[model samples]
Target: MIRIAISAALLASAAPVLAETHSIEPGDGAQERLQEALILAEPGDEIVLAAGRYHITDGLSLDVDGVTVRGAGMDGTVLDFTGQQGAGEGLLVTSDNVTLRDFAVENPKGDGIKSKGADNIVYHRIRVTWTRGPHEENGAYAIYPVESTGVLVDGVKVTGASDAGIYVGQSSKITVRNSIAEANVAGIEIENSRDALVEHNIATRNTGGILIFDLPNLPVMGGGNVIVRNNLVVANDTPNFAPPGNIVAGVRRGTGIMVMANDNVLVEGNLLSGNPTAPIMVIAYVQPYDDERYNPLPREVVVGENTIEDGGYDPQLDGADMLKAAFGGELPPIMWDGLGSLYVSGDTPGWTLGLTEQGKGLGDAQPAPLAAPAPAADFDETGIGAPAELDERLG
Candidate 1:
């Protein structure tokens, strides 16, 4: 029995490491090949996608576990989505234990890569771009994650996204590092997630450079996060306009890194500087739950060790006065946006009223006056910008 065991161990140790590298060319029936290879792959398989443009209209869904999707680097491999449907979202995830590295996903119409209901996913050395020369659509986001956990998004360069360069919502246990979110809607957004760590990232010239929110109205909750040691969050307040569903609607015209309704969260050791808007904004909640089909109030939020560099000067949307006027004195650092909100900080019970949209015409409960007349720009980036333009503070 000892000799048999020794032989078995020797064989196991000497087993050949076969990592099948599948190739997917432009018209190589890449989808079909990928499915087959994924089924046959073991723990250490690599699907090598070659240098070419893969025209996927509906985008790709990656669900296989313990697999790696390798490409010919960001410069060589491209998933070009110039025009597509379904909110322009590309590469949705439904499984866990996935690793996608060294590739570029260009979805001008939708999100670059969206992972939903996934865990233990790693996106490394990836680049997502939506800019061709000077013309940039909504680079919605390079990485949009929802209902995911244990994620690491690193060494990525995202440019020219319309909404947010990287929007992470309803996720937990995440880390974003050594990445760049430039000239997009929002550089980095963590909404309704938990146990997150955002560090060593560069955010520049997107609406709300780095935003974290609880958004209790999302039917999801947010908390337990940290933003530490980042650099160059600047020039995000462009107010470059677009219509709803135009991709740009979600970004490129708002505060820098809006944080709302989160707890156990810390903003420490960050070099947030030179933005067109406030460098660091910690909001109380999403507010006015009536619009999102739920109550939009926030609670149990924390702020610490943050550096707010300015564009904080707005004649109409004066956050300081708004806080002092509403809450007697000294606002909650960050409060919820909009004039239609029904709740405030230090609340114990959740909202009792279900979300209703009946008050749109009735106007804000106390509209915030407009800073200036509504430019032909986009208002979605700043929920209160147009409201401020309307010369009204709903809060």
Candidate 2:
């Protein structure tokens, strides 16, 4: 009897442990069913959505660690939150080791999908968008991951955000690749974040193509070690329609890429074209904020081997009038605001802007000192930074 019991136990241990799968079909009360599944889900559970549209009124949240929520495909499975009332986001994830894939979320009131304070989260083949065109009332961000570590956003498409399309803020070890962002205020913004790689993405017709920014009064202050390579940023001449109080509202239109107040950033091997403003701009975080903890300088920035074409045709001479005046309204491929005190080459105390090799059709690099101090009125009226508020809300 003991030998038989031992053999049975060994067999049981050798069998694979199967995770529970909760499948939700498209029908009335589907959102409730999804919420119930999430409430009852334990670790290693999988929630699968059917290949149809689910009209969700309230936002859905998943807090179970090591759980996966997937759909049939990005095109087949749709979560439409057009009339959402209860939640500020379509889906909120606050669990570790979570994977969300193969789904489309649309038209949330605040943000499309947000993951907060989670580690090892993966969003793959997911689409978040507004069916309507770009408007200020659209959600602030699509596919936003904040204060999270080991996050990967791959093969995603985002559009019609009032702020950024794919925004990764205050996070570490992040990667956003093979993504498409368009018709947003700023596409693919990495703010107050570190150790990120953004590559193989296409950003077009946005206010600004890609922005690496570090704002003040955030828990995560300085951002560094970011690489943006092999991306196509073109024709980002959409007018800035962000709400008046937001910081991105100050972003000039027709800008291809803007790097503000970050360190150790590299922009290389990208194809940029047809931006009316400058193709690449490097400037300090000159906003008037009283945060002593914030480092406002951008250091160790390398702009290497990027193909630029037909830029500086009609520049948006909004904030930096000095740049427009100095370049005679025809800006160069790369424009740097000489704000750094560190010496780069032979007694020239300017920002460490490096251009190793230039591509064809790019104008000369124009690194000039700021003509005057930034005006205090240029700061956004919203006193508290949005990212800090978002962090508090996520917490």
Candidate 3:
């Protein structure tokens, strides 16, 4: 009896120690209630979800500071955006220090999950798909984060996202590793971001595999996008159907390693092969042909020590035709080692992987001063396109 009393006392003491955890069932407007859960969740709360389908139309939003949401498992839990009333964005998270792991989101009207203005967020072992398969208007991204920082996205599998799979735009201090992306408009694009480490990512069978771009037309400048050691980035054949009678530029078509207006960027220790066109590209977006830019002034870009196993351009073909076929007509032909029996487009002038004088020019080996990296505090993850000052990472 005394021993039983002691056990009861111990159990009572431990009861308060248990952290609060909540569960939301399938039919409970799981999408709407997700917001409530975030409101109620404390720093370290876990929100466990049951194994069932949650149709998200309005979508799940998060502003909570720090929380962890885990599904039963990737296959064990499914968040279906199918047949939802309006456009579906399965989950949109805009919080800091959050984690959403081990779940499946499908057929989101927009991007499956867009984590904007976020920091230190992790989407681990998550799967995104479109059950209806690859539709041009299906959704933009499987997992898209903008202006985020200190993020780690791993163990993600994305299929049939319309725009891109796993797009990180304007983020800093990020890492995207051990993920697989396939059958999307573009696979794994890191745009206008800085100090990012991308490794061990498999981008295959998509329109563009493993792209890093600094879209120059925008008012805000974009630079410092990096691509690091990774596995296969091969043949990106998938392309959205063209609008009737309209032709889009191949400079924007199926490719591997697309970078423009990016500096101090690194592409090393990677295997890029079997692209229908150039397996690796460093192309100039339609910049001015005159005045102060090279073959005029100087801009910086770096492409180093990567194994180009097979495939590149066929410039004898009409550049327009080649682009429709997905050859980014960025760089001119090259000196073929003759290992693959592929003719080098060396006949075409002014484009080389490194600096050039006429087209796609950064000029000969003159170096841009190595700028210092910025601290995390100055780079805000909560705001969109914060001012790019020298003190910040974009600086």
Best by TM-score: 2
What is the per-residue lDDT of model 1 for residues 1-395, given as tens digits with 9 covering 90 to 100?
A: 24345436655898754555666676756655654555555455677888877766556666656678888887788877665554546676667767788888875476788888777777777888875611344545678877876777777888776666777778777777778887666677777777667777888766567776655445566454444345556666655433465323533354655555555444555665555334445333322444343333333333334454533443114344653354343222232333222222222111111222322321233433212111232212111111112111001
Q: How many backbone clashes does candidate 2 have?
A: 0
The candidates, ranked best first by lDDT, are 2, 3, 1
TM-score of 1: 0.68
User: In model 1, which regions exceed 4 Å deviation?
Assistant: 1-19, 26-43, 83-88, 132-139, 240-254, 290-395
Q: Residue 385 CA error for candidate 3 (Å)?
A: 19
Which ten-residue region of model 1 has the weakest summed lDDT? Answer: 385-394
What is the alpha-carbon RMSD of candidate 3 to the true structure?
10.9
User: Whole-model lDDT, candidate 1?
Assistant: 0.57
